[model samples]
Target: NKGIGGFMMIKNFKASEKIGDIVARFPKAAEVFKIYNIDFCCGGDRPLSQAIEEQKLNQKEILERLEEQYGTLRSMELEDVDFRKLSMTELIDHILNTHHVFVKTELPRISDLITKILRVHSVEHGQTLSQVHKLFGSLRMEMEQHLIKEEEILFPKIKEYEQNPSDQLLAEIISVMEETENEHDGAGDLIKSLRTVTNDFNAPSNSCASFVLTYKRLEEFESDLFQHIHLENNILFPRIKA
Candidate 1:
């Protein structure tokens, strides 16, 4: 049974389950799905095994990592908490201060780098440069709107519920959060596409230092996003779940 859960991890999602359903039940799968450019939200109704095979990924390696990371995923204690039990205002403040700040600061830098690289190499990598631009624009717009929606609508309602917990308010906030999560899925898709268009951000063998630095920065940005999303999706939202 060692491989049952690992293999089954990819196997079950193929049985008419949508991407969001799989991701909702197995959040860790997001990390894997992101790696493969699978649309686990909007275009989520596909076989996991087929997706993997079509991408030519090594299933053994994926299964091994899945087993290592989430072999006992079912028994994991992921519980909802009363946001009232904690400081909702402070949590919102933290998300804005840290994550929003990161987004604002890093996005322009990535955009500048994309423009720079395209200026230098677009003639040689025209299609990739075009994709990079498209991905960057999509991500920037999506994330900006997402943060606005969360801060203006969802977070405020969540805070209100903290002070005055009500079923009606909680229901509305949950609905909003679920929508935000789907947007997160799309943002995740943009990042995956960006990496692909950048050739995994591999600078040419003869690339200058600026090219190397840009790739490093992009890599760091993606890593930070993974952590940022994890905290929001796994910790913050769960705390507010009724």
Candidate 2:
């Protein structure tokens, strides 16, 4: 009976479930998934089993970890609001006010920090810093444009659809959502490239304050961006599609 109960506990997180759906349900699972190098954002459309198999991770171990984390965290008062319960307008507002504002504020700050680090440490870390600068620049452009598209075009359409609820409006919303998702993939790839270039934002031992801060901010940027993407990709888009 004890063995069967333990097995059932681990089996709570079904292998066939979508990675994004899992994160959507248990928000804290994102951190656990990150520790295991699981993609719960742009690449989150696929099943957990596929991701585990491709990453060559132990299935039982991953499941056990997920189940344990979720069980513990589920009882606690987490900072993350239950996005699944928010209305479409509320969710859209949350995305715009939270994630969109974050990008607008952080992009320039991180950009300047990257430039300063590049100028100061270029001679020593020129190759890596140069790559970081370019990747960050590309990501900045994509995010800026993406925010505009969502705020001006897609979001308004969604709001209008929510008010009126027409099939034509839904179709338009779906089209824009698809394009937005593709752009997300582009930004996600650039973020991954930045991480690779910076060796997962690990600064050197001989680094100055600004150098260290740049790496730290970049990692923070990645974390926030992942959460932002997760909200849109997992929660918002799925709700609209359904």
Candidate 3:
């Protein structure tokens, strides 16, 4: 991972500007933002220019935003500050508000929808729906476990460290975090598969409200996970490491 200093600067203020709004707007930068544990999907309300500035990045130092649409580029910067020095607690709050709420609310609904869809569409779309069902179950179960580990095992330890930086506690948290990260990857990949199985969540022409809501919630849920993982893997873990 690049030291926070080596992180890429935003290119094309307009293209990258959808930092906190819709994920579809800045698909390319999604990867970049993912690296920083920044949310450019569900919580993508800030402009790219603003996000760059907020991070206290070197504005003049950023290369052009790399997009297929060549030559459409812009530059940005903010008042000098360092993101590496920010509080992990603040970032954790963002994760809890955005991602945790998403999982807590959306996961059960998606699970129910998949169960319903399988009964309705499985005869025709059995293959895809079955895969979707499996993934949905896997994600739901895994995430529940992941949440317990974070809330019960990890977050408390992190707090303990914040109160008193003990090498022993840090090592333990790091070990658990490593496992949590692997689960994050699995969950992320499963979400992508869910998208594919659902045909980008475009319900059939004769689809019911439940079907539509299922896809819609899945997309939103995926967006939530990206932000959640980004914060933990990129921001939270690093700060604790430091």
Best candidate (score: lDDT): 2
TM-score: model 1 vs. ground truth:
0.61
Q: Candidate 3's residue-wise lDDT over 132-229, tens digit each?
A: 89989998998988887886788778877887888888899899988998999998888888888888978778877877777777776776587578
Regions of candidate 2 where Cα sits further than 4 Å from its true position:
1-80
The worst-scoring run of ten residues by lDDT in candidate 1 lies at 1-10
Give TM-scores for every candidate, taking all chains together and pairing residue i with residue i: 0.61, 0.68, 0.63
As a whole number from 0 to 100, the lDDT of residue 23 in candidate 3 is: 41
Scored by lDDT, model 3 comes in at 0.65
**Considering TM-score, which of the candidate structures 1 and 3 is the better prediction for this target?**
3
Put down candidate 1 lDDT per residue, 1-242, tens digits, no spaces. Answer: 22321221223223334456555444566787787677777766666565666778776676565444444432221334333344667656555544564566577777898788878887777677778777888898898899779878998898898789988998999999999999988988888887887779787788777677667667666765775687678777888873
Q: Looking at candidate 1, what is the lDDT of residue 71?
A: 41
Q: Put the candidates in lDDT order, highest first.
A: 2, 1, 3
Question: In model 3, which runs have C-alpha deviations exceeding 4 angstroms?
Answer: 1-86
CA RMSD per model (angstroms): 17.2, 16.4, 13.1
Please report, in order, the local distance difference test score of every candidate based on alpha carbons: 0.68, 0.80, 0.65
Give a tens-digit lDDT track for model 2, residues 1-242: 11121211223467888999777545556887899999999979999999999999998888888777644432222355687988888788667644564466578888999999999989999999999999999999999899889888999999898889999999999999999999999989999898888888999898998998888778877876887888899998998999
**Model 3 per-residue lDDT at 189:** 87
